[model samples]
Target: MLIKWSKDLEIGVPFVDADHKVLINLLNQVDDCITEQEETTVLGSVLEALVSYTEYHFTREEKLMELAGYPSIDEHKNVHQKLFHKVRAIYHSFAADRESVQVDDVRSFLQSWLTSHILVEDVKYRSTCIDKSEAAKQAGMVPFINTNGTHVPFNEWGFLRVLLVDDNPNFGKLVSTILKAVGISNIEVTQTPSEGLALMSRRPADVVLCDWVMDEMSGTQFAAKMGEMEIPSKIVMLTGYSIDTLQTKVSSPNISAYLEKPINAHNLLDTITRTAFNG
Candidate 1:
């Protein structure tokens, strides 16, 4: 099935929309490969590409959400972590038991997951983020080009710095890259939650993007530690899981935003831009 991009999905963030276009194209390629009855070798190559791209895309999104100070980031990051593990486990099983691997299995999984994620969870955040961004702009926190082509400098837009925290080294790098791409220069990353917390104590960032689950400390635990330490940065939890499960557990004074996994760069950027400018 062709997943057509529409205006409703535009969250006023440019880079993220571009990434989503790539993601949909890749998913379509997998579908096409399945339809062509491609050999296992070809199918495996496609699957590998899918895995690699998905990992990168998800990391980009989580980092953006973290930068935006999304309140539900932890839940979203959890979902991404779980899905990554699930996909990786399946890939490993296929490699170990080649005879049991089927093209249909891979196609079905990717199609279902991608479709649901984009249409449902992702769309939900667009309006909220847009409103927040516009509000920030109006409040003179973020500068925007007026209709006459004049630029307005907002004091709040450039004052904030951020840190991206995740256990995956690749993810941390990817996040840093995306941040720089979006005009955020003062960005730091750490693979350890402890280091992220330590950074917070020494020099509190304006915002933080943290993964939901990590080997040493979960994002929730890290956020709790920040609160205990009286760290003042706005915490945006990153997760790949359902926010419903974490809503009750996460209270105010720590988390300012929550963003789901596979976060769009546009929404993430807008969120961060707004949060920085608004704050």
Candidate 2:
């Protein structure tokens, strides 16, 4: 583990604390990639996820600081900017030449930066009174929700095994990249409905994200096959069509949710968590 989370490291702000915990988990995942000497693509995905979430979290924090009327918001953002740029530099360097990047150096830098920032810098905001926007003041900004309208815990994301089926290899790659970028480690991409079905027969995925429109067969047909086979997988339909207009055509109960493409990390994760986990 890169860092062990404790109360002492928290800022006592609900949303911030929650975000920190998720960040810690991602950091540990990054450490795992480094230690295992994982493939460049896997490391890149993890780093992309870490970098993406870090940027978003920083934006959220800065907004909260503004809402709280914190005097040092500018200074805090400067600190954030510097750190963000540094991380980005590391990511880009890896992307440019994976072999040239020193894994140990990356590990040590992230480990220190995350722990010290949380314990020393973030601690300053714990007691800062942000009496307005109770929703934003709490963990409401967590940006993850299931069909039941309950927030999905960010830590549970790593446990998910996602299988994606889309005819387009490029689109499949894009979706798998988004999945990995959201900290989902176990993902398999299949190009055809038959391949997806065959693979699921051998090993059922926790969730199957299938494109709505396939060349050989439609997503509904795929879902129907899975339903008939009693494959215990949540089917999240990915389509370019309007959700309201498209949802009407879906008859299979296996399809738990429908997402309009093009997809991003937040919407994709939200849909998966909402459907697959039943929470």
Candidate 3:
């Protein structure tokens, strides 16, 4: 089966998108090699490359998310740990009994996992971060008259117009309510990234608060797509996963903040205010 990158899979973050492209290419290469029934030497090399690339990619992503202050970094890390262990085990099993590891098996496993992870879980975070960033920008823009009476830019208190994107309607509503409680009245809640984007297109927001995992698109993909659109919104990613692996795919300017699941109302409000108004 051929795997292709389409606009639907983009999350608008440039660096993350580039990394994902590399990963997809590497995965496809492995699949191709397996289909050819290549010799052990070639297969071994492919496996090694895949392992190395994954490690590097994961590291880059995790670090980026951490810098962005992703709250569920720990949980996301744990997922990566588990996946790495599984990959190692699979590699060993294949090395020991090459005949037992079929190309189709690997392809099936990777395709299913990657597609589900990217399209659903990853896109969630992207939406959140973009919304937050846009909110921040909106809150920060200020104009004033200069000495010559010409309108000039002035440093103004930043505020966030947050757009909370999540599949859980209750969760979205709850977040919006919390923001209002904290004096953040400009909030929008949506169940899908598409809806959030539609809203953004009409009126840009300052920031985005997104869930890391979802059913349609992963947070990362959503963020990348927003970057692709040249949106100025800052992203704050959320997840219930370990921080380790969570960091692997989340390094970008689009993601400016992060929070873990079971979000603390006080902390969340503080983070949003700080990220939005404080620049």
Candidate 4:
């Protein structure tokens, strides 16, 4: 089913409303691609477009919120960041194995995710911004200018030393590529749990992206041990396993976030940023 934009989704912001229209159209295109059983590349391309456009829309929307001095801006920004990460994870997993994931599933997921945010979360900003505008009009207050860049550049993540723990070299390389794309250059890829431990012992990372199933030990065990050792590094689980099983294993507080594979650039960076900086 295709998602249709309705007036109920509008937040009384012209630019934001326009961006939402484009996002809805892009999601509909993805639904069409799934219906047509388009090639994997085609589907992946559409998902990439959606991620890129979402980032753009979010940057602009956040700027508008900042200008209006919205009281819940931090909470709203967190929601936006999490939604993008969730969407990217779903698309990346679908792109990896299109046969297992149906078009209807993707369509339903996107529709619910997008519509819920618009109606529930975004609606909170509507009355606040409208009231601010009216008050400014009455008091003759000038509009705030966007002097600082609204979009946060990826260079901010460069200082983070990330340790990637996975048995598969290819998966490690893929994650390295994604990290580099987000301007994270200080990365140490270790194929075994012992190697990862050694690297951490020598120089602790700001963030550690670890796989669930490993040769010597599982990612869950490593995270539990790390917790016992009380390492300061934020640990993010990277796995294709069942989330239910993953949840049962990660009772320890060391695991900061669990992301599904094959991971996309947007989600990996978002998870890292949320784990390392937001905390």
lDDT of each: 0.63, 0.75, 0.62, 0.71
lDDT of 3 by residue, 171-212 (tens): 564565445433466788888988887787777788888878
Cα-based lDDT at residue 175, candidate 2: 59
Off by over 4 Å in 4: 1-152
Clashing pairs in 4: none
lDDT of 1 by residue, 1-279 (tens): 546667765656555565566566656644654555323333444455556556766766665665556788788788788878877776566547655667677667776776677667666555545445433333322222222322224333345589988775544544554455434678889989998988889999988987787899888889889989999888777766666765666655668777655454444556665555455
lDDT of 3: 0.62
**Could you tell me every candidate's TM-score relative to the true structure?**
0.46, 0.59, 0.44, 0.49
- Using TM-score as the measure, what is the rank order of every candidate, best first? 2, 4, 1, 3
In candidate 3, where is summed lDDT lowest over 10 consecutive residues? 142-151
TM-score of 2: 0.59
In the range 1-279, model 4's lDDT, one tens digit per residue, is 387777778776665675677678667656655655433443565576678667766776676667777789999999999999988887778767777776677778887887798888888878766556543333222211122232234456668799999886545655564565445789999898888887888788999989888879999889877777677788898777666778776756777788876455466666777788777
Candidate 1 residues lying further than 4 Å off, grouped into runs, are: 1-158
lDDT of 2 by residue, 63-149 (tens): 788777777778888899999999989988877887898888998899999889877777676567334466355534544334356
**Best by the lDDT measure:** 2
Better of 3 and 4 by TM-score: 4
